[model samples]
Target: MVSPMITEKVISNAPYAASAVTVIAGFTVKDWGVIIGVVLTFITVIVNWVYKHRQDQRESALFNQKINHHQKHKNN
Candidate 1:
């Protein structure tokens, strides 16, 4: 039996496939601009959210350490 071969060229052409479909569907320059804007905005929001979450985690850890240290010294 002969199996299908999936190569790098085929994988890289995936974007072209989407472009072909969009072209066939008559997407204009303005449509592409809106799509690009929305994608960039979504990516930016996700990056900021991830950064803020990590910062909060770090601050919480530092606060816990300070409380623990103060308690230890208060008892001495």
Candidate 2:
């Protein structure tokens, strides 16, 4: 039980949808700088991760030394 008015409206918009798809499909990427920018962005993230890991290791070692010193003082 389809209405003729609704069917006409849908049929009219079908060509526009196809045209929009064609336009989008024809688009192209034309930039070398953008590709290089993405690569450097990932490199910066990796370097930051390594630096943070080393900082955490140093902090953990310092905390352990402090705890050992406290235990030695308490026993004496």
| Candidate whose TM-score is highest | 1
Off by over 4 Å in 2: 1-30
Q: What is the TM-score of each candidate against the true structure?
A: 0.68, 0.57
- Could you give candidate 1's per-residue lDDT for residues 19-65 as a string of tens digits? 99878689778988999999999999999999999999999999999
List candidate 1 segments past 4 Å from native: 1-25
1-76 in candidate 2: lDDT tens per residue?
A: 9999999999999999999988867656744467678899999999999999999999999999999999999999
Each model's lDDT comes to: 0.91, 0.91
What lDDT would candidate 1 get against the real structure? 0.91
